[model samples]
Target: METRIRSEARSYLFVPGNRPERFAKALLAGADAVIVDLEDAVAPHDKDRAREAVLRALPELASVYVRINAADTCWFDEDVGAFAAHPAVQGLVVPKAANTEALAHIDSRSHARLALLPLIESAAAFTALDAICHAPRVERLLFGTVDFQLDTGFGGDGEELSYFRSQMTLASRLANIGSPVDGVTMALDDAGEIFDAARRAQRFGFGGKLCIHPKQIAPTHDAFTPTEADLAWATRVLRAAQGSAGSATVVDGKLIDVPVIERARMILARAR
Candidate 1:
């Protein structure tokens, strides 16, 4: 197996593959990774054009992935074909991935050593997550909140879709994969709302968030990365528990245990 690509911060910015101008800008915008979206963002008639543009730009990206249409889409085969031919492509984000078979096809066809980030958007896909993640190419699970809400008739409020989001995270953990990505916060201008949403997702074991706009990237990264205070507290807790074992350790009058230690280590790792 290829070594997993670990993201230091948890903000992924989406840029339209058709818009060549935004490609370099997104990479420079400090997002942990840039997802060059060829599906949804591109018009049906422009799919071929967008594919060409993306192929031309792939060589310029530092860390990037392509979001292809689902396997059943008319353009799915073309999307995979284009990616397979591009040696610069590092990863692929398959939207609305329904099962392992779709991923298996991608694995069998891809010539480029690309990791798979499956976007779980439908109820059926959620149910099939266990089998889906077991696919050889799958690296991370990404929740597609907007499409999911549309498919399930769920509301946008965080509470309404909490269960689904949690299920995705739990499934990723069970599969021993990288942390699941929370869906994007659609409020582009509301930094406060974006921050709150990212933090909430973090609490739910989501290691990262998908972002639509460049403005949302900074706040999302901030929300996921450990703050100075957080790092200090974590360092202190680890030191206090250096020679200790058992269920808990008291740090600054607060009790800490395995769960707390695990969280602290995650914070420290992100810090590094």
Candidate 2:
């Protein structure tokens, strides 16, 4: 199968693999992509059941992903081995991907032309961001906020994790991949908290936010999509640059350059 990286505005929703009833609903829930999670979402006793359910439901899925457990765990080998033959699985969101060796091993074994989105949770992974992104199979980097917070011993909100988040985003850009994805906001019932956290992620240059519940999808998408005002401004900026010779130009009394132009084009493309 031909593989493509996730380019559109992303609001990936995670559904527990054992919950087959929620699988169909998640696909129809208007998320950019659905992540059938067998890792954190599944209890120890339910791992086998979740795997079977996900395999059974794969044939019916239109656009979604399967997040298997970490490769270091007892279930990791089984998880990858079981799904190796499934063609419908679009990509693998590998959790706690500490190095390129793990990614190489997974890619070498899988038959599917599966893209990899490595989860950068540990300090080791963060420190090795360059080598990880250079891995031929990696397509994007996903920041695992909660795991990161725990790994770093940060308490309360995730203010302490900003440096790591910024570093991952920069690494992804330098590696010439799609924008980095922000981790999920775990407060499922509170829309206000979800929006605030997602917005903060956006400000930090995250292209998307992961969602644990379907209810968070719409709000996350809305927060990520560019507004009409933003589009209009981008258009004016580009028009101003049309007659300029230098690398930078003035737009709306502000300086604009290649980065600004690129961001403007991204907004307009998504708006289209």
Candidate 3:
């Protein structure tokens, strides 16, 4: 239940709950986490079957996260009831998360056993970010970039969404939640594009990226990992700052202040 232990996870790969046949493949795909999706991935007619399918699959599989339907949907309660106490469930990836009251209800239903990953996908969610982050058992926030664009009428996902992305990061920091996760890259065949997008998310202060395809995993991990040069620079910074006795020092011609030293430590920690 100490979900913060997983705050450093870099990739969350989504697998359709209705397609149980693909579960094993996804679990072995080397993602930081595998999310069995019962939300947007499942068709209406298959929702009940998907729920049952997950119930059967959970026993045979290792613990994995489940992305359930939003609280507004009829399927929401059923999804929570079925998986709240399931031993094989690591947590619930709650979609379209906005209301803190509903989040409290979900926590009660789960008896606080499951971690909540609130997907910040709408304007309403942005407005209530701090409240949602502070909601009971919320382990992390996820950026639902695609749905957010549709909801907010953004024509593109580039610089247009920068402000909102930063807001999510700031809200997460204020709430002491894990750095928010970035949404998926639509390109399945292009690892370069996926890597670029993941790097962009990292620049915006996101801790992870959602992966729709297994192919996206390696590049995503590569993007999040500190490069050799970065590690070397961080090492130099730490060495330079040592024995400074709280005084500022110089590293690579730049003044190594407390913030710079702290940043170096973070970079080294990430490398580890």
Give all candidates' CA lDDT scores: 0.84, 0.81, 0.89
lDDT of 2 by residue, 1-272 (tens): 22335455478888998899999899889888888999999998999989999888888984467898998888888888777546787778899988887788778777556777889888789779998877866778888878877887778446777787788778877877777889988788888888888877888788898888888987887788778899899889778878686657788889998888888888898777
**Candidate 3 segments exceeding 4 Å error:** 1-6, 243-245
- Write the candidate numbers in order of decreasing TM-score: 3, 1, 2
lDDT of 3 by residue, 1-65 (tens): 32342367899999999999999999899999999999999999999999999999998766688
> What are the clashing pairs of model 2?
none
Return whichever of 1 and 2 wins on TM-score.
Answer: 1
Candidate 1, residue 121: Cα displacement in angstroms equals 0.7
Which portions of model 1 show Cα errors greater than 4 Å?
1-9, 243-249, 255-259
TM-score of each: 0.91, 0.89, 0.95
Candidate with better TM-score, 2 vs 3: 3
